[model samples]
Target: MSDAMIKVALIGNPNTGKTSLFNHLTGLNQKVGNYPGITVDKKTGICKLSKTQKATILDLPGTYSLNASSADEKITIDTLNDATNEFSPDVAVVVTDVEQLKRNLLVFTQVKDLEIPTLLVINMADRMQSRGISLNIPQLEADLNTKIIVISSKLQTGIDDLKEAIISYTSLSTERCISAGKIENNTITHPELLTSLSAIELKKVQHRETIIRYQFINAALKKSYKIDRSKASDLQAKLDRIFTHKIFGYVIFGVLLLLIFQVIFEWSSVPMEFIDGAFGSLADWTKETLPEGMFTNLLAEGIIAGLGGIVIFIPQIAFLFLFIAILEESGYMSRVVFLMDKIMRRFGLSGKSVVPLISGAACAIPAIMATRNIESWKERLITILVTPFITCSARLPVYAILIALVIPSERVFWIFNWQGITLMALYIIGFAMALLSAYILHKTLKIESKSYFVVEMPKYKVPLFKNVAFTVIEKTKTFVFEAGKIILAISIILWVLASVGVNEKFDNADAIITESVSKNGFNEIQEVSLNNKVIRFKQSLADEASEAGKTITAQEINSAIAEKTPEFRQAVIDDEISALRLENSALGTIGKAIEPAIKPLGYDWKIGIALVSSFAAREVFIGTLATIYSVGSEGDDEEANTIKAKMESEVHASSGKKVFTFASGISLLLFYAFAMQCMSTLAIVKRETNGWKWPMVQLFGMTAIAYVAGLIAYQLLK
Candidate 1:
């Protein structure tokens, strides 16, 4: 009944459906965090084995064997070797693919030799019939000296059987398929012993050991397993030929990309608009209902505004991850990795770089970590340095708002949305820049390294809806909660700075505005606007009076207009007071101080403030604008108070030109595309590289690049 007594670890090779089983077990009751003292992701979840019993399931990183060749493998090796490790499993579930049982068993035997209780789970059992593969579960359990559970994650079958096996895992044999002594110094059981072995020497020993294990596996499988090669279908083969073809493959990928962008824009639009309007109304209601106070103002103008900015883009983020999960689950991502090798070689990268580059579309932190799979250090480093140039979900909020504001929402060729095309173009530009940078770094970095690229071509299948749903939920939740914390803190601080001021100008803003208004009276335009409103009001009143068959004098109309004039005029005066106060507040001073630096990029002081705050997070740029605009404005028409509406209405104080113009919007997009604006990303880079040197260079180099690109874009477009 105790939690400590029921730790179950899922272990397997890549593409073995290990994660699918984990998702089935965990559902939404899961948490993601970093492993202690390392940046590697650790996923843990709890599954109920029975009405009164539950077990903790830890999904370890996928690795081929106990050979610890990569960082991911080393973690597995270290955990299994140390009995005292908290994450070390009481029951190790070795998941294997039915189609590749031989290769998957390589790690199973290694784990079995460690004297740990083990269960062999043969996944994708649903495919066994189609592939003409049959296994005698009882006989295989007897031969391999472990309990076997045949489960199809796709069909959601055999899950209860697997759970029953886990509850009885203590009875399973820990007998090794081959003697541990076959491995030199028994390093498979005692990983610390591997510290003395050279990389080449260690690999040779692992190779010899693997050959021995396979011999034992072949003899056992000969008795319990049967297959008919002719029964297998060639549908996958046919599809792979086209998908991996050199010429047409790239074309298909391009078309798929355009389609994805179009869907992201078109499908998410209705939900996004609804969310924007909801948040705007919530902010308005908070101000109107809550008793007036500084806290009330902060709640409405800061936290809610900041949150609304990022939350409105959830639909787009979810759709993006939905497509990515589908691609990965359908096994097409592997083909992509294989397909990119030809071009990768020419650019001084390995085919393995493609995974990180594509994964960077979701986030750079994970993409950088994915570089560990690359054998060569030089290629890995180049991939890490350039992966940030690939546009991530963090930049999606900035891009979406700016594009909607500046780019027309018209269709191209009566099908493609202009905004969608622009978005796709930006994505392509990011990828092209990443590849170009990789090529340049390839020529510049002189580190000597050589490694051959090898990629697995997985059998394509229909993506599981459960897997796709979990991925979208997990990824979107992480984006909101993680980015929300930083935005919240910055928003509160920005609210304080924008509300209070250090100088007399901010303090005397109300008096200054009142004195000026009183002295000059209404300006020509203000007088005309007031006169037109009075005229409209008079006409409406006269019409209503006439409809009632009552005579209304011209004097009564003048009296009514005079009665409403002061109320309307005061509203105008209050708006000017709010604006003047914000312009002289602490936030405004900071913005002005940095204005000259960003002015060349077609940015004003307000945008300078957003840019500076967004260094904490790139997505915070929109949130920053939201908070600033919320703080600067008073009395909003509920229908037109969304963040986009506010941004669209923004104009330069000096030139009176629109702030989010076509030139400035393009300039900003180019800046975000090239800028390494995320402090967390910089920190991660520092941790990954084991020093600040590379991240520092990354920071300055990217900023310089972004500035130059923005400057050029603005100058040419304007």
Candidate 2:
């Protein structure tokens, strides 16, 4: 081994346990990013090959072979071919399933021809005997001209041997598995042959090359691979029959979804409430403890409040990813894609589109990137365009807040709450709308292309707990830190906007409120509420005195009440000043400007501000509202300053009705469900489409639909 680190590339076809091996090697060391100039995911991690030698492992996208049929495979080919590529490996580990050794060897041979130091890793060796599979590792090594290691990634066996092989990669053979001249063509095996060929001619050549490679693989496997027909089990087939059944499959998936949503709500409620209250108290304590200053105000009212809106939803987001990870790791998500294929085809999509669409539930950026596997340009474009409408984790924050505020928490049947049912409904609606939009685009778009869908059904296994935990942690962190950055920046900007104003009213708010209160006292509603509070205070004091066996006269009671009444009035005056000041501030001006535009949809100026600010990301809606409501709220009752509490207490300026009424909450939910609010999604769409034309359509076109839908819903409900 050299003093410098080794670069090892992990390559394999989909569902070959490649990810499991990567996780086993890297543990928590891996970081996900994008390829240098592409949207495809680049996962890299460090592995300790030995005490003295560490290797950088790059897990390339899963591809069947290096035929360059799709973007993902193109990436694999491009990396292996270009030595100067940063991620190009010093050694390549070709992972193959023990059961599918022959087919997996196709790519192994392709990598061998690239003249890289390559080795084969036959994964899932633990299942070999049960599946009636056996491998001649020594014979296969000699036949393929590469070192072979058989291991089960799930069982974590033979990993040390694989590490040792990687450490000694310098000794691995660079010989080709099959000679290029052996491709059986009349044309000479010269470099000029490829240069003179057109793309169509090149494709034909590639196809012929694949055929030759498979033939060689078959001959090699005939001597090295064997299967016992009598020992194999039919369990996989039996499960597949039931899981892929048309009616039962849909029912199972639906029931699973319902259960997931129910758990998300019920399991997360306690933590969410705790986080909400904790943040509220922290903000209050910050204001009380820190010397009164603009910095303290920003830290409490702006940053803390804004982040709390998102942080409180961590439990629910984690639960969402937990279920998604389990389904994926258990090999069930593939069955879902298979089951959805018929309906997808009816909507002008193929089963291949289902992965990206379902993945959109996590985030649209990666989901759109997943469209790289869709072979047809038209289908890929449609998947990319409509994917944002599929309710993502970002929308979960918005939906959770609105549903909690508006929907009754009463249980449906005996298990599901109305809130959970509403969340599930929104998800279903999002997916339905995506398919409907795809159907419309299929009829409208003039792009002509032909494509077919092929899905691999991997053998089912119990999901590894370690893998599930890693996924949940990684995905949840991504959501938090990514959204946290946007929220933090916007919160600071919004705080300044809400804190400073050029208007005289904002500057004179304290004096103006004091004088107004002096002249008119409290309003009828305010006075009545204040009097009730005073009565309760006096009665409590009298009861306490009686309990002490001391007589309290009416005059003494009146004197104590008088002292507390002034403090109570002062609180009211300070609160009034805070409200007046915020209403006249810069944010308020902007909000008021847009109020008329949104008012018809049952929103006030504050919600209008939140709506506009949330364009950076959908989850920002909650954070934006949290920041706005927290502005100048220091004088508010400490127990009443939680984001939900503030919103619940809010009333229309003139109408005096609650702001977050049932009608408005539903309208808001519908808007976020359909709106193209995420800038990141738009950027990814632009890059994926290679132009701005489609992304622009998504921005304006989807927003228009959202506006109309919200308008109709609010009107009918209100």
Candidate 3:
């Protein structure tokens, strides 16, 4: 935790158990952030090297070699090359698989050539014995000219020994294993020098360097380590036969996906309803306890409502990462990639792209960054462009509410539910669109780049509860805190727009109500209640605001009406007045103006306004509707129902039917599925693409598709 701590860079190839070691060392202390100049993620944590001594560890993106291929690999190369860089480690930990020792050494030798002390960690050591692998530790250490520590990241052994080596790093040599004498010291010392070569010569040098490094490693490993290839290969082949079978593998993948979606969809709702009510009650309590003023109003209407929209989705976020943890811990995702490679190849995407594509289900920002290992610019570009089309958690709120409106809440065959099926369908649609679009781009772009996809299939194990728990916590916190800030800001801006009007009618609501009540010659009781409501409205808009102990509430209004006349009749009259007031308000007028644009999609003006507000972020759609409804609502009953209920109750002015029809609901669902409704996603894309060009294409292009799709669905359904 102190500033004097030693910094360690943990580098490894994909599937090397690096993340497991990191989690064991850092526990819950890790923080994920972007490197200053790039969108590539930098994961840093403080690990206690000794009781009093701490070491800062940065888990660089996993890459197979020091030679850069993608944006993320450049980060590793940049950090490793710069001795003066902030994250440049005093020592580096090169974690590699013992079974694939020869292949892993390519990266190790490259790191050693950087002239930094490097500790070699042979992880997954527990599997070594069962797989009939053995190492001559002392000879291997001497031959490699560096310390080697064998550890089981799964069993948590040899970590202390690794720490010991890290502390004694000062005694380790900084000599290059493969001599860099032919290359200039400046080029060797700094990473950027590699970029100086032209394409042909650069490829030649990179190819030669790999050959030399492997030759050296093969020489070192002679008589030092042995593996029973038959035993290892037999187990992998046995599992691969069934799991990667053309028909059975796909069936298994499909069934597993259905289980996850169904479980998440069903179990998350219990917590979601509780969270929704808790926030709604909190807002009501705040309005009731705090003295009536703009501050209280903002707290109840703006901040609380904004925060509620996000917190309700925490269960969905938790389920997403939980399932991810299961796949990663069980080692099934790697095999899935292996099985899908052929199909993905036809779309001009590597199996490596599958990781980013699946992750796109949770969020696209880091998912796009995950494509760094794809090793092909054309494939990577296609992956990035189409990733946003995948349904992200941001669209979950929109989908959930809209689905509830159209799809019934009923179980299918006592095992499946209509709601769960719809949710899964959306995910499938997104992935389908991503692949279809990738294929189209492949045919059109005509760009070429190098492609390599070599992956390790780790032994399967039961998912550890601790690992799954941490993943859920980290991802859930990320969604709530990071995305929550944006929601809060947007909510405040929406409050101003929805609450106030542009003209005298919007401004003088109380006066307008007063004039109507007086001119209509209401009975004595109705007159008093009408005057009281106008007074309260005037008090709410006072230039010099103050705390008012007595406030008129919808419940109290209901009670007053019940005492004087039929409550239903009073509700109708009040609804008419409230509707009239909002019609003249600025937000309502804006909605009406845009009604024509969305009319074809089966949405009225109010839905149009919500759609426009949510253009910056889809989660804001429900909150936008809630805010508008709250602004125009006069009856106390509106507060009792959830946003889903309030929206369901909405009636079309011209048709007198519910606004949220089957046609409209399906149309909205389709629109949000394909639309680039999140500005943050676009901003990240712009940064990732190094310009606004691709982001602009994503925004306009995706929205155009969304519009057409929605129009078609509504037309067919209506």
Query: Which tens-of-lDDT digit does each residue in 1-718 have in candidate 1?
Result: 3434488999999999999999999899899998888899999999988776789999999999887777888889878878899898889999999888878988998889988899999999998877667899889998889989999999999999999888887788777777756656666876765788887777777766776676677667777777653464567755776887789888988888899999999999999999999999999899889999998999999999999989999999999999999999999988888888898888899787999999999999999988876767899889999999999999999999999999999888877988999999999888888888899999999999875653446778999999899999999999999999999999999999999887898889889989988999866545543454466567768778989999998888778778888866875577667777888999988998999999998999989999999999999999999999888465424544799877876667555567899999999999999999998888888888999999998889889989999999999999
lDDT for predicted candidate 2 compared with the true structure: 0.87
Ranking by TM-score: 2, 1, 3
lDDT of each: 0.86, 0.87, 0.78
Residue-level lDDT tens digits of model 3 in 1-718: 3437888999989889998999988999999999987888889998988877888999999988877767777888888888788999989999999877878888888888888999999998888766667799999988888999999998899999998888888888888887766444233355564777777776666765675666677667765877543345456555766787888899998878887878887888888888877777777778879998877877787788777777777887788788988998888888888888878998988887888887887888888888755556788888899998888878888888788778997998787888888888988888888889899999999786756565556777899999889888988898778767777777777677766666777666666665775678554444444444444444443422335545566666555555645443454456555566677777788888999999999999888887898877778887777766655344433234356656766777665667899998999998998998887888888887899999998889899999999999999999
N/CA/C clash count, model 3? 0
* lDDT score at residue 77, model 1, on the 0-100 scale: 82
lDDT of 2 by residue, 332-359 (tens): 9989998899999998899989999999
Output the better candidate (1/3) by lDDT: 1
List TM-score per model, in order.
Answer: 0.69, 0.70, 0.67
